[model samples]
Target: MLHRVRSKVYADFVPEFDATSVAKIKAAGGIILGKAVTTEFASSDPSPTRNPWNLEHTPGGSSSGSSAAVGGADGSGCAGSQTGGSTCRPAAYNGIVGVKATYGRISRYGWAPLSWSLDHVGILTRTVADGALMLTVLSGADDHDPGSLREPVPDFSAQMAEHDRPPRIGLVRQYYQDYATPEMWAHTEAVANLLAEAGAEVEEIPVRGGPPVNHSVRAADYGPRIRAGMEMGMIIPTSAYLKAQRLRRQFRADFSEMAAKVDVVMTPAMPAPAPRDLNTTGDAAFQVPWTAAGLPTVVVSTGLSELGMPMAVQFGGPWAQEGRVLGAAQWCERIAGLNQAPPNY
Candidate 1:
């Protein structure tokens, strides 16, 4: 995927895989499945893959093929990447599990950067367990990625054990109630209520002032950063970049502080399910804050939309808390009882 995108005629000098990363994947006993399609540099542009549920609609991108390959009618459990809502949106659109691990959890040594500050390496799969398995194999710090954290990797798969007691979950007050579609919001609320009824402590929590505006600015400005690197032969401006970094730190701190009181934060994965039109990808507003904070986020399909398209809720956890996040997501998956492969491939 990296090689092909880098070779494109209009390729704008994005990152590419070096031999060392490929050697490492092989050395780790990983085999290459065929590459999945991505949006240009994993940004806003939509791709050609059709949603398995309805071929006339989009499958979502920049990880379009990965999600379709996994949750499409074939029932092949596959993995894909997410930066903003790439994995989660498709998971919601196609009815699957997509997890965007905390930034630096997976090595960014090989991915083409959409935004150095906001980019995350993630996975899309048929179930939370499948997503967790892929995350275990893919995650770990790498010297090649300066942004990679040196923290010890957790055993995510082991954390899948079902608990007798329900988890304490928090719903960000504004996300579902305000920004999401009525059907999407209703499904998320229903899941929360189900968790509560099943012995979980589910409650609303305010995010205070909400996500930083500069985060979006930084994401949008990344194109210029990549272009500047190519044209001027200079690195990105540290001061400008660091401002976003500082905001990221603030978001992480705030999110962690909130997570101290809750096992997981839940909200609709996207404002709605897949839109019928293929000309544009849907919103990323619901995903940006979590991405900027570098929090572990999982998207679990609740079920079909009013239009019978798929929809999902996102679960987020504190840094390095992917195990708890995945476990909670798995629990939700089992309880929701909505896991089903898309109708047509």
Candidate 2:
């Protein structure tokens, strides 16, 4: 999806998807799957694809087709986007695994920016192992994106295998209980119980006022940054954007402190499932704080709601801890026994 978008927007953007990308895939013993549709510019615009589980509902977007393609009968798994909940929401809506890595973990060089500060490349798959496989292929620093970090990308799949004992997991008390729907809250509790039964020490903890600051900073920066980028040909405002950066630093500090006590944090990827209408994508409130703090988050489907829509729980870790985060999410996914296929293909 991102490859197609980049190729369309920038003429100079040569997509690796052509013979070269395909050859690379084959060389690596992979296959060329069909292309998935993306929201224009990978923004708020929803795609026409319906939820695989129920044709009457949306599959979620910008990575709409990607999520649907993964959750749908093709079941190849998805590589979605997140500038808010684009990836997480759709994965939950379609009952698949979605991963929103730490900001800058995956190079954003080819992706069209919605909110430069908030945008992230994420994956949606039916299993945590598949998600990790895609991440291993896609992650790494790219020269084209200056913001892309130079850190070595670890073998995420191997990390998932290394852990024997369950780690201490922190349950975010505020957002999960406050914003989620009754069904969502119930699903979350069931997930907590499953994690505990799997030997994880699940403890409820208060996430301080970081979410509000995260929302505010993101709100204040997105509009102005995009406007300035349009009018003056810049990606972000150097001055006002500083506030978001500074706030992010503080957010990282708070999250790091929390991580010191718990190996991983569990929260819902979105407050609820996909909205009824495709005209508007659902809120990304649950995901903002993680993006703001530059932490790695993996969305794993918990179960289907009474309405048959999907619900997911987010497993997160401190910056540069992608391996640990993916491992824990895989653990939770196994314990929950959620591996259902969506209804539509």
Candidate 3:
């Protein structure tokens, strides 16, 4: 039987009502396995949930508990929310599958809000198939969530139904490679070769514009530093924020054009594997761009890092292309041959 655990954000903040995603899970015959931990208000504040891979290491957050639980034997899967790397980062850190569908792809009706513009409901599970199946159940427009997109919900599972050939994957190595540890870069190259050997047409691709510059706007609701910035955001002049929004639209346009040339874009999910520190979740740099552009992204474990912790690669597609993004991720998941159980599990 399948179960969907809620995060602490839902438990502590809004216990009375099931988030739209949670309601969908129950309707689809999934058990509500109770709430997992979340960072304080889903921000920089740390949670008690440690990485299952290494108890001393950090489990990425604010979706910490969701990812950690899904990485364990006790839970089947859980609903995570990502404003930045909350979804994909934790999945990568814990060595599991995580999906951040396009912005508004999954209704946020009852989910707690961070940056309304950037927050997205996400899925963390053991496999791409499970992620897609859960996504199919959780996706669709909700009358209550004004931010919800009205696009038709396709059978996400069927979209991932096997393909005759591997996908043409575009490698965007500039920012990702620049920020990643050498070991991560090398591991990524090795995985690319593994995929190519399995028949994925891999090619280098150039990128314009770097990571999004509005972390302040997104992280405003968080801790002191970010909250200070959030306070500034309140008085930063509407014109400036509007200008940033316009620039963001152009960024989205550029990414869409780029996506036209490939079945999926691949990059390291995080600059490095789960950091040894539990003081903070790993950096969100690898995920901010896609989240900023509202593109669909999937994180799959590539293998364990040098420390025997998991390493992962994230694949993203144009907006609302969850099916394509997930399909490619599913293929890579199979060929990468990295799905071993974490030690101690």
In angstroms, give how far residue 190 of model 3 lies from its true place.
Answer: 0.7
lDDT of each residue in 1-345, candidate 3, tens digit only: 221233332345435777788889889999877778777667666788899889999999888988988887557788888888889999999989989999998898876577898889989999998999999999999989988999999999888775425999999988888899999999999889989999999999977887666554345344564466457767878788888888888888888778778999999999999999988888989988888889999999988877999899999888777888888998888787665777877
lDDT per residue for candidate 1 within 93-137, as digits (tens), equals 788888888888777766566667666776777778877777777
The TM-score measured for candidate 2 stands at 0.85
In model 3, which range of ten residues has the least summed lDDT? 1-10
Output the worst ten-in-a-row residue range by lDDT, candidate 1. 1-10
Candidate with top TM-score is 3
What digit string (tens of lDDT, one per residue) describes model 2 on residues 250-303?
A: 777887778667889998777777777867656777877777677788888888
Q: Give TM per candidate.
A: 0.85, 0.85, 0.92
Index of the highest-lDDT prediction: 3
In candidate 1, the residue pairs with backbone N, CA or C atoms under 3 Å apart (3 or more residues apart, or in different chains) clash, namely 39-62
TM-score of 3: 0.92
lDDT of each: 0.72, 0.73, 0.83
